[model samples]
Target: MTNLALLGARLLIGALLIGGAVQKALSPGDAGGMLVGLGLPFALVWPALIYDALAGLALWLGVAVRPVALSAAAYCALTSFFHLNVFQATGDAWQMTIFVKNWAIAGGCLALMVAGSGAWALRADRP
Candidate 1:
């Protein structure tokens, strides 16, 4: 049951990440505009898209889980810093809420990192 739960969680998180990456990659111009609004370099938007897409793939495939989790955690932390600190300074409560939400997701990723992909992963033969 616990393993099933873990696999379910992994699937959910992987789906969300993949969906988000697809959306961003498909509309990088719009995402870039949003990133610009968030005070990030517009050039970074493309890299962010690539990172999201690859990370999502990694998570979905259960390959290089540790590195993927670490990268994702780092990305989430940076995003939270920007939204919570920089954007919140502009008095956007909603944005701050989103930032907190990202932090929560990051926490989940951290847990997955420590717990690994369980027995249902494609990379189960590894390690």
Candidate 2:
């Protein structure tokens, strides 16, 4: 049961990242605009898309699970800041919800890091 749960978690997170990359790839102009709005370089969108795809693939394949999970956790936590705009109220309540969701995802990644890949993984790098 635990291994199954871990696999499910991995699948969910991996799919999320992969889907996000696909979305960004489909509409790079939109992604670039968002990055610029967040005070980031528009050129970053390309690298971010690649990183997300690669990281998602690594997690899905259960490769170096602990280290990948740790990196994913950090990625989630840092990216959540992009959604946060506490000072000036933009009247977009869903932004806050997304920010919280990112943190939750980060927490999940932390759990995955501690638990390793579990028994059902492709590589099963058990902690």
Among the numbered candidates, top TM-score falls to 2
> Cα lDDT of model 2 overall?
0.85
The whole-model C-alpha lDDT of candidate 1 against the native structure comes to: 0.74
CA deviation > 4 Å runs, candidate 1: 125-127
Tens digits of per-residue lDDT, candidate 1, 54-107, equal 788777777777667776777787777767664556787877887887888888
**For model 1, how many clashes?**
0
TM-scores of the candidates are 0.83, 0.91
TM-score of 1: 0.83
Badly placed stretches (over 4 Å) of model 2 are 86-89
Q: What are the clashing pairs of model 2?
A: none
